[model samples]
Target: MTTPVQLYVYDLSNGLAKRLSLSLTGKQIDGIWHTSVVVFGREIFYGQGILETRPGQSHHGKPLHMIDIGETAIDEDTFNEYLAEISQHYTADKYHLLDFNCNSFTNDVIGFLTGGSIPSWIKDLPSDFLSTPFGAALRPTIDNMFRRPIPGAAPTPATLQPSPAATQAAVNASPNPALAASLLQAVASQAFSPSASVNGTGSSAPAPATQPQTSSSTSTVSAPVHICTNPSSFHSLLRSHRAVIAMFTSATCGPCRMIEPVFEDLAWSKTHGVGKDRVAFVKIDMGVGLGSQVASEFSVRVTPTFLFLLDEQKTYEFKGADSSELRSQTDLLLFQAFPPHPHTKLSFPAVEALSSEPILFTQVPALDSVISKLASFVDGSSSPSETVAAKEKLSQSFPVYLKARFPANKGAQPPKNLSANPQLIASWAEATRTIASVLPAAQLFPLVDLWRLSLLDQPIATWCSAATSQTNPVHIFMSKAIDALHTADMSARNTVLVTLRLLANATSNTALVRSLLSAAGHRAETTKVLVSSLLHADASVRTAAASLAFNVAAYLQKGRMDRLRGDSSAAGMEVEEDGDWEVELVSAVLEALSNETHSEEVGTSFRAAA
Candidate 1:
């Protein structure tokens, strides 16, 4: 449902001078009042800021004007946290008579909450009041009026409001795994809180998406907003995030600076509401961030220019600094790009509530002995010698230093730091990184299979942070498997491919696969590996490759491979007309379908790919 944010306009002067002030300046008088933002009908940050001056007297005795600033991208919990962060800057100490006051604080809150600034005149009233010689003379009196000491009272900011730019991290790391994940899921799915416990062991079966999302909460990107302060990042942004709002601004432009608050307000301060997928807001200061030639490539001569793009195609273009219109049109652009999911009808309350209850992977991880034994065979040097007898003894005793002990419950306590995997996962990645060159081609696939199982046992939350990382064991193992998929031994090749297929089924998540492929630092190459594996001689390997392809295609269906679709050459590979390897992979699946009619298993996998 569309939940419009509430904006409160309080008239401090109560219209007493509106009739008189209009005659003085010939401008319409809207009364002198305080402005504030109220979410869900309660004002937590403001109103109290202005209470010292107005008390019970200057309410205007009128119904506070409420302006709907479109649907909120924040939930109540996150909204409360965000209020706290801005409150640091909007403290009572920061209030000024002619510079920063109630109106300024309200504008800040409104911008933070809904990414829409309050009315310009409201925000400028104090400055406008001071500009007048009469009001300038009265500034001291007004300041004294607001600065009056409260009788036996404390400060408001000392008590309420703040965001740490880390709500996602908090949610991901909640003590109650279900609660934290439900909180995030609530933003998108609006699901109710879930149970803390999960049942069943891990298998080559897809875990439920709405289970206790505790495992995956271990990973998080601090903030979604990427400040595009330069050209290279801007170019990269163009290729990623299916839906992007590019606020083209300049340092010297007055209006651009004016609406820059809008950038601060609407940026990724919040990532809930209708949809978080493929939606990104980027601020490109064209003057400083993009050079003149590069700016011309985007054809930006004007400041405050906005480009609304979906799937790399421009959907809307406009030049304006009007914060409201900019926001409304951006909302419209998000609507055009990502329409509301059909699930918004409120018909499935049970299902909506269940969206937070993710079933975690509870299967026991592989024993250290298995990993140690697997490492033993592949730990040998590339050139063998009579010293093999001595080397075998050392390899036998070699322990797998990169083994982690996963908890039965993902949200049990302090979550494991896959990002800061200084030992186990890092050692695993190092072993996989050089193992291919060290081990014979025939044995590489079996070694990779063991590595895959070791990683597969890791909770999805361990590897899938909100960042692109290859240092994690899951990524390194996949990178190693990319080599194993092409080994000369059909048995080893099929084993590695089948293991990938099994892992894909075990966790039907896009973040895991994307993170794995993201390890190689190039999506096209990893994609090529998945596609090239389809041409393997063994039908089962090809089928497993196809199954892996099918699994990843589900990731594509969700727009996870935004990196694969870009302007760069495909590392000298053949480019399709549209230049998406995703298309080529799909075509390969179809071709395999035509040639292979015998195996029911391969056909079923191909059908899933189709």
Candidate 2:
């Protein structure tokens, strides 16, 4: 015959106890069975029992009692006595009494004592429950019982107060808002003074009071100013003053070591400025642990990180190792800190002085004699051969002036080799090109030929580099060259176009728009050729052309609209008959017009006319 066993389980955290049942037979006794017991506040509250059984109906069919435990309403003493009886009857091997609070035991015993299931809350028990210096100790037998994994034991609620060490750790981890607010207020209340005592002896003294004091007003009179000493206070001072100089450095950094003296000198000199009270100098030492933390917060990877905080919001940073470099950086920071007055214009005293220099015209004996001879030769009518002879003689005697003014040497030797002197070559080309425009065509061709040969073998990148140099005016020369090439023979035109196409494609040259505009009118034929080239077979070339066309259209619409209006032929042409270039140009104007749509009809009409 078989009977069902009723198992009871208890949960302490939720204060709920539940019961379950399973059937068991004689043959199934050898197999494992699982159940649970629950304890709360050092007392076992309930026990659960589990059993395994084979499938069958009892012959008696009297609802056989497979296993029966008496009521779970037993108190602690009765429960312990029952546990002992069960433990002895099962030889401490077959049956088990599991205690979650015990220190050492086996899993099977734990499974049998508790039901087959484990409660979720048992995982949070403290490792050491009563091993305190104050003589508190966990019961040894219970500690031994708890060492094993009970199958269905409910966890102990975590109600223990934190240990001293743990509480200290928590306090250290969290920021104290009260302390932070107090520190901030303390910093804000203290002022920063760059007086003679603080920044060395100064010429200017502190301003005296101007307002007259009455007997009643004596209480409102000012008191002595106190300066902030700590770094946080210093930071507050800088914020209030809107100072620019902030040096972030480490004591061990070599660069910081070198620049510290220079910084000190500058800091001392700042007191002499008009806004001495406004200018602040602050240095942070990133050597200590707290400094390292701050450095991490600021994301400062480099030492000697000089930040020129122009205002509270904007900052310019300079990172370097040289003292001289730091000095130069300081100059720029000073410029940012105390910018020039808005109404004041910049002036160069040397240039202004040179403007007043007396002009001198040097007498050239050769040119003077040549002019006289040419005058005499032109005064009389002569045969074609005689005239040609006189002109040939004058041309042969003409002195070629090659006066060149090189840029002042900036503490460097000029390259002696002609091949290396790109600046000189570019400048010479520009001067010759300019002179060619007003000079006779015969004289111009020779200069152009010379420049073409000189630049023939040079790399495109090299040519571009020369063109974009700050000191060289290559755009001006290029403009003239483009103009000359348009009117020149087919070979000359092809040469100039090849050069221009190279310039257009080069990434370095950003002045292409300006150069093209300069070449637009004088080299209309070249412009037409370029515009036609845009429709070529190559995709890259086509893309570049499209971008250029848009850029050119926009630029012309903005800068050369008046010039386009001045053209008499364009004025006569009908709007519909206008070419692709004119259509694109007009489209750009239309787009600009759309933006200014609110203007009155008179304004619109005037804009259209212009």
Which number leads on lDDT?
1
Worst 10 residues of 2 by lDDT: 19-28
lDDT of 1 by residue, 27-126 (tens): 2356665554555545432323322112122222333576776666667776555444333233333333344455544554555455556676665454
Per-candidate total of colliding backbone pairs: 18, 23
Candidate 2 steric clashes: 23
lDDT of the structure predicted as candidate 2: 0.33
TM-scores for every predicted model? 0.38, 0.21
RMSD values for the candidates in order, in angstroms, are 24.0, 39.6
Question: Would you give me the overall lDDT of model 1?
Answer: 0.46
